[model samples]
Target chain A: MLAEREEQLEALLVEREVEQFLYYEAELLDNRELHEWFDHVADDINYRMPRRLMRENTASVFSERGYYFNEDYGSLKARVERFDSEYAWAERPPTRTRRYVTNVRVTRDDEALAEDELFVEANLLVYLSRGDSEKHTFFSARREDVLRRRGDTFEIADREIRLDQTVLSTDNISIFL
Target chain B: MAAGDKPSVTEQALQDARDSLDEGFFPLEFFHDENLHDLEMERIFGQAWVFIGHESEIPEPGDYARRYIGDDAFIFVRDESGEVNLLFDSCRHRGAQVCRAEQGNTSHFRCPYHGWTYKNDGDAAGIPQKSKAFKNLDREEYGLAHVPRLETYEGLVFASLAEEGPSFEEWLGDFKWYFDVHMKLPEGGMEVIGEPHRWVIDANWKTIADNFNGDSYHTAWAHGSVLDLELGGEETVGHAGTGDSLDRHIHCDGHTTSMRGFEDEDVFLTYPEGVVEDLFTKEDLSDAQWKLARQALSFTGAIFPNFGFLHFGDTTDDPEKDVAPFFTIRKWRPLGPDKMELWSWGLAPKNAPEEFKERMYKMYTSNFGPTGNFEQDDVPIWKGITESANGQFASSQNLQLNYQMGLEWMSEMELDDEWLGPGFAYSENLEEGGMRLFHEQWYEMLAGNDRTDATGTPMNVQEDQ
Candidate 1:
C-alpha cells in the first residue's frame, strides 16, 4: 500500500512538470519570442495542422492529404525567421493574442512513445485582436504533442493541431496557432 | 436587375464608369456599393461563365462534392454512366436541401425532412408515401433542376446561368492558346492534388480580379517577405520592368496572362530533371506552345469574371530545400459587396511521381493559399481598400483610383511585335493595360452590353509605331 502511494505521488509530480512546461511555452508564444520558442523545438520535429473537414454522420474528419502546415525543422525555422524581415507585413503591426491552455493530460505508458518521450494533450483557446479595430477573433483547438524529456525540461518533438473550425473566419491565419 | 428590367445601378453611373475606364480610372465607390453589387450579381455572374470544380475532383461514378456559384449551392456529382452533373441541392417537394455533407459517394441522396430521394444523376428515384398521398405527382418532372449550361475544357468545368448567349468556345476565344501551356504541357495533363483551400475574407471579389488581371507591379513591394526569406527567387518575384528576365503581359480575348522567362533557355519551370524528362511531351502542344513552356519561369493569369491561376517555379518551402514548381488555380465568389469566398487548388502533372506531386502541393501552400507567406499580406491590404471605400466620402467626392500606369500619356508602353501567341503582348511587364481591359469589360456588362464590345484594340496598341 505504501509503494502504490509513492507511485501516485511520482505521477503527480510529472504532471505538474508537464503543465508548467506547457504554460511556459504559451508565455513565450504570447510574448512573440518566436526565436526563443523555436529554440525549444527538437531538431527532428514534425509539426502538422491538417485541414479539418465537415461531413454528415461522422463527427471527426480531416482531409486525407491536405494540410495548412506540414513542416520539418528547416521549414519551421524559415517560418520563424520570416517574421524578422521588415517586409512581413502580415505581422508588421503584430497581433495581440492571449492563449488559454487547459485540460492538460500526459501519458507515459504508450508503447509507441520512446522511454524519454511523453504524449501530452491539451485544449487551447487563443483570443486574437488584429488591426486597429475593436473586432477580434478566437481560435479553439486541441493539440496533441510528443514531449521529449531533457533533464528537467522538455522539447516539442512532434505536434498535431486539430482546429475546431472547418471554415476559418479570420482574414488570414497569419499568426501561429 | 433581379427586381425588374431596369438595372440597379443608374445609367448615369454606368456612363461615368465607361468614361473613367476610357481614361484609365476606376471609381472607388463601385467596390462597395449595395446597388452595384446587385447589378453585378444579376448581370456579370448571371450571364458570364463561372468556373466550377475540376473533373478530377469527382473521378468516380458516385463521387460528389458540394459547390457554389454566387450564392446557389450545387451538388457536383458523377453518375453511374460516368457523366458529370451540377444539380441544384434543393428538394423538389418542400425545397429542402437533400445533400447534407460537404462531399461523399452515394447512389442516392435522401432529404431528411420529407424523405425525397434523388439518384446520383439528379433524377428523382423515390418519394416516401408518394403512391398514397400524391398519386398524380410525376417523379419524372420532380427531378432536381440543372444549371442552364455547363461546359468543360481540358478537365476544367465552367457553368453559365444564361439560357442563350455566347458559346463556351466563343467566350474563351484565342485565350485558350495561352491556357493550353498550363493544361496540356504534361503527357497525361494536369490533375488537382487535393481539396481546395477555402477562406472567406472581407474584401470585394473585384479586388482579387484586378490583382490577377496582371498587377505585376505589386509583386516586389507586396510580397517582399517571400523574397527576403529566399523562398522565391528575385526573377520570379522582382520589380516589374527592372529584371533582366524576359517579362511580357499578354491580353487575349478579355483574359490576361503575364509571364517571366529566359530568352533561349529550357527552364521547364525548373521542374526536377527526372519528372521533366519522363512526363513532358511535345505531342499534344504546338511548337510555339512548347517554346513558351520550355522558357517559362512563371505564369500568372486570370479568366474574367473571376478565375485566376498561377504556375510558378524557383520557389521552396525552406531556403535549404531544392526549388520546385507549383501550380494553383483559384476562384473568388462574391458573398457581398464587402465579402468574398476564395477557393484555391494546387495541381500537378497527372503522370508525375507521387513524391513530386506532394512537393508541388507543399510549394503551393507555402506561397499562395490563405496560410501562404505571400497571400497573408495581400488579404489585409485588399480588405483595407474595401473599408476605405465604404464611407460616404468616396461616393460624395467621386474618388477615382488611378489605373493609368502604362497609359500612353503616363508612360511610353511598347507592344511585342514578334509575339507568337494570338493575344497582344506588351514587351514590358510594367504596363496596366490588362487591368484597364478588365474594367472595360466590367463596365460593358453592367451597362447591358456585350462583353466583347469592350475588346477593341487598346489605345496604346492602336497607335501608330
Candidate 2:
C-alpha cells in the first residue's frame, strides 16, 4: 500500500508483513475460528485454486476452467455454514487441523495496481494433522495473494491456492488449506 | 473362461431371483456378492452404452482426452472432419499406450516406448521409418481400434462396449426427454468445466447414487448450514424426514427424481429480477420458479446401475452478492464392493453470460467436489457405511434399505404432488426399490441375456430380461 500507514504503524518490513499475515491467518484457522478468518477478506473477495496437471514440459494437462475450486463471498459464507451447523457430521466432532504456512517469498514481478491494491507472491508449506491420524499432508505449489487495503487494514481481495498433487489423497476437504 | 466365471446362476438361483421379483423385491444377496460386481464390469459397463465425454471436450480437430468404460480405457478425439471418435487407448505398434497424458491437444498421438504415432482419426500414421521398420506393414490394418460403436445424444457422447446393445437413443428411451429438457435442448447445451474433481471413498457406488436420488434426509441435519443460507425457516426442503423431511418424490422407469421446497419457495428469487429474461428464453422461463421455490426446481437424474447425474446443491446469496446455482454430475465409480471413486464435474450452459458463468462456477466449487463445502460431509456418511459393513451383525444387517413407496403407497401422494414423476412417489419409505431395480437390471445385462425383450408396463422402460 503506497499511501503509507500512520506514523504509529512504523516502516513495516515486507517480510514482516507477509509473515504476520501468514501466522495470523494460521492462528485463526488452527483455532477453528472460521469467522475471524473471513474478517481477513475484503468485502468482495475472490478465491480460486485452478487444478494442476502432471505432464511433460511445455504441454498442458487440462484447463477445465471450472476444474479447480472457485468461490465468491456468499458461497464462502455458505461454505462456513457447514461448520456452523450442528448437524454437519463432517465437522460434528470438529476436525482438529493446523495450517503451517511458510516459505514466504516476494518476487521481482510483484506489482501494485492502485493505492489500495497490493499484489505479493509467497510460498506456503502446510502441515495438517486431522484427529491424530497421519492421513493427510499438505503440499501446495504456491500461493499468490492480491490483498487490498480498506480503511486501515489489509484484507484479501483475491487468492489463488495451487496444490502439488493432481489427485487428493484425503476423502473430504472439510477444512481450508 | 475360468471355472469360477462359469454361470453360477443355476436354474435354482435364476428361478429364485425371477420368482422373488414376481411378488416384489429380490434377495439382498444379489447385491452383496463379489461376483455381481465382477459380472457388472464385464457385462453392463463392458457392453452397455456408457457416457465418455461431452462433444465440447474436444472442440478442435487435434484435441483429445482419455476416458474409461468400466476398466477398459479409451481415448476421445475430434478428428480432422470435426467429428469426435472414441477409441481404445492402446497403440497399434507394440500395444503401447498411444496417448499417455490424461488430456491434451496434439496433431498425432505417439506411443512413448516405440515412437509409433496415430492420427486423431484412429489411423497408424508413422513408424521409426515406415520403409525401414519392415518391408511391408499395412497401415490400414494397424490403426487404433475404434470403439465398436460411438454415438452422441444431445452433445453428450456415449460409447457402447457391446456392438449390439440397444441403439443409443433406444437405450436412453424416454429418459432422453429428461436430459433434453434439463441438459440438452437448453438454449446452449452444457460443457464440463475442468478435469473432473476426483476422490476415492469407502462406500458403495449405490450409496452415492441413492444419496443423490433421494437422500434429502441428510440435508436438514447434515447440510443444515447450506440449507440455512439458501432456505432458512421451515422452507428447508431437502431434510428428507429427519423429522424435517420435505413433502416430495417422483419415481419412474428405474429412476428417482426429487424436489425440495425451502424458505425460498420460489426459485426465481435467486435470479436478479431484471436478468431472468436475459438468462432464460420466454419458453424456458415458463413460470417454473413461482410454482415451488425461492430458487426451487432440483432434479436427481439417476439412469440406474450406478451412472448418476444429479443436482444436489442450492442457490447462493443476493446478486449484488453474486451467487448462482451450482449443478453437479457425480459418477460413483465402483472401485470395489465398498469402495468408490467419485468422479464429479460442474456444468454450465455454454451460452451463459460471463458473470453468470462465474457465479455458477463459484457456487459449484463452494459446495461439491473434494473441496466443496456442502459435499465434504457426504464422505463421512459414505465412510460410516463402509465402516459399519465390517461389524459381524452389521455384515449380516443387509442394510435393510427402505423403498416401500410404490404405486400402492405413493399413488395417493402423486395425486396431490405436482413434482412427482410419471410413475414414482417422493416418499422416503419407497427408497431402495431403485437399488433392487438396479441389481435386477445388472444381473440381466451381465448374464448375456436377451436385450430386445419386452419392457415392463412402465413408460418407455427397457431393461435386459
What lDDT is reached at residue B288 by model 1?
Answer: 93
Candidate 1: tens digits of C-alpha lDDT, residues B116-176: 9999999999988898998999899999999899999999999998998999999999999
Q: Taking the tens digit of each residue's C-alpha lDDT, what string does model 2 give over A1-177?
A: 545664224434655675787788878887888898988877677777788775545443435474555667865665665577666677767666666666676432345465656676666665655443446566555778787656655788888877766667566777765
- What TM-score does chain A reach in every model? 0.97, 0.79
Tell me the DockQ of each model, to 2 decimals: 0.75, 0.41
TM-score of chain B of each: 0.97, 0.80
Docking class of 1: medium
* Each candidate structure's count of clashing pairs: 0, 23
Q: What is the lDDT of residue B365 in candidate 2?
A: 66
Error of 2 at B128 (Å): 2.0
Model 1: how far residue A64 lies from native, Å: 1.8
> What is the two-chain DockQ of model 1?
0.75
